[model samples]
Target: MKKPRLFNLFLAVNGLLLGLLIMLPILALLLASSPVEIMKLLVDPEVLTATWITLLSSFCALPLMFLLGLPSAYGLARCRGRLRRSLEVLLELPMVMPPVVAGLALLLAFGRRGLFGELFSNLGIRVTFTLGAVVLGIVFIVTPFFVRRCTVLFDGVDKKLEEAALILGATPWQAFLYVVLPVVKRGLFAELIMAVAQSVGLFGAIVMFAGNLPGRTQTLSLAIYSSFESDPQQAFALGTLLLLISLLLLAAVHMLAPRDRRL
Candidate 1:
């Protein structure tokens, strides 16, 4: 009895310490800037441009992520054996790869002098160090996060439900649309919010591939970095805003998650 009680106490103490470690810096950042100052920063042209670029790039990446990630996730969820393991590792490579390295890899794959460089050059399309590059970087970095979560959501769905719909004269696509999707729609919505939260905060890859060009490729995270050396206060304010957006998106994700699956 005493062992169990002591272990519970130990776990509680450690959990509290972990929570504090995570929350303290966030609280400090939130409080470091005054509301008025934050508002002023938001209205600044540079800040506004960065905010717009961040949002635009994230939104642009969403469709591509959905089109590409959903099929990959569904396939991953249904697959088994060594092939599944290999595919999972391949899919997750971006998440584990260092951001700078990922950026370099993207550059090599799509840059003017890259493998497809001549083809893109002939088409008069430039990829690197542009707004398209920003979107591409976000898609590369964020797709794995979205796909992993969605794979879990897809896995949780009952195969029987899909089978039943097919037996009821539905095509595979129809069954997936009317049956499997509805069951996981809430979870999918939650994952979308999570994806957006992850997308908006990407810094290193976006900077390396897109270049931190103000009013062009610059995002809120890059803007914060640019402001930090010259104006720490402004950076703090931007950080606070970014943190608030992330916290709100995360809260929405939690709310949308199924009760049994809530974290």
Candidate 2:
């Protein structure tokens, strides 16, 4: 092995420090709670319901994202022009903004007096304080994760594969499903896991848009907040539950990461 340079040594130290800083809070949260209390909270109706809502809502949004985001991500990946770049920037706008601001934007856009609100009201749909609104808030914030990941994965795929499929008379949709998706399946999983994770822990936007009504739209994070105010032990227990789910999902993603398989 070659000897490390001075700069490499410094880089190693910096990376170690960063790792410790990030891991400390997670370790602390875990250490502060007991297994029994965590299980108890998990079985509690209020906590269980919110956890279900967060997980189900996140899972529900993923299919919609796949159906819609896949085409957009693929198009953005393949395009080469200033216009495409501008559009990519625009799609990422919500990601760069504050979470509360993003929620507020959703509220105004879908709220009582905004543009689509009047139309939705005419159709007898009240989004405010509804589960649909929670899903919308999640999709708004998490779509970028899916789009960004899929776009990069699609870009890396050799365009020749698609060309060959096209040459064989496969239609565009068929080519993508069979030829393209198989290659980027791992990245898609990573994006899906991340999107679900974000939606699971989401507090600001869901609370703002969906109004934290128990058994209506109360998500895990909101439940945690409420518990924190009312019952500290239950709050930590709920938090420990969220932390475990997140950690497991991340571990699964790591295990599923593609291992140098070619398309």
Candidate 3:
């Protein structure tokens, strides 16, 4: 046999093995539950409440990301030199930081006795152990995903189009709204969907920051962890749902990605 064919065969087998390694556990868990079991789990009040809380918290974080994260991303993309580099590193810290560490930082920054905590406390604004904390925890961890993607999306867009719009007498805001945003809308949509998917499956950070309290701060991931030992069926049901959504989100990302960027 030819050496090139042998190398290609090796690569194919290696890739297949890695893909299975990533997906087999999820596949097994999904198969473990029957439709009837899933239906029963869905009807359970605890399950429903946790799902709703997770969805609500995720929804809250989504808009905030669009409002704040997009502008930050645009600035990062347009800037260069030491300031940009410093800002990028700081923005990326949460991605590499342990969720527990991130949660601890959040606690110190917002907890009752920590810095700025007294300010919130004085105003009778409670953030810890609440749905708001869950949203904050999620946003802290996931905003980077959206920002990084949007930065890339904006960077990839042709500046000439914006310049042309400006030369045509359009205001800066109008140019961005009508020209730049439309060009990158698909990528933005994909990033937002991926962020939501990530939030639904988040556990460690949310657990540390929000402290699971059923019907309040308990997200789907936390609920699954709590139920897994005592109720494997319920855990499987939730896991299956999350797994399906994750797969769908991934597919959307791949479909939306440019041909050159797609895996």
Predicted structure with the largest lDDT when compared to the true one: 1
Q: Candidate 1: TM-score?
A: 0.96
Every model's Cα RMSD, please?
A: 1.8, 2.3, 2.0
* Residue lDDT tens for model 1, 1-263: 54668889999999999999999998899889999998998779889999999899999999999999998899899999999899889987998999999888898889888998899999999998889999999999999989988999998999999899988999999998899889999999999888999999999888888898999999999999999999999999999988888889999999998878354
**What residue pairs clash in candidate 3, if any at all?**
none
Which of the two, 1 or 2, has more TM-score? 1
Please write out the lDDT profile of model 2 over residues 154-214, one tens digit for every residue: 9989999999999999999889999999988887787778777777887788888889899
After superposing all C-alphas onto the true structure, candidate 1 shows an RMSD in angstroms of 1.8
Number of clashing residue pairs in every model?
0, 0, 0
lDDT of 2: 0.86
Per-residue lDDT of 22-128 in model 3, one digit per residue for the tens? 88987798789887887787788988899899889999999987898998898888888999889889888999999989998999998888898899999999999
Off by over 4 Å in 3: 1-4, 252-263
Residue runs of model 1 more than 4 Å from their true location after superposition: 1-4, 261-263
Clashing pairs in 2: none
Candidate 3 accuracy as TM-score: 0.93
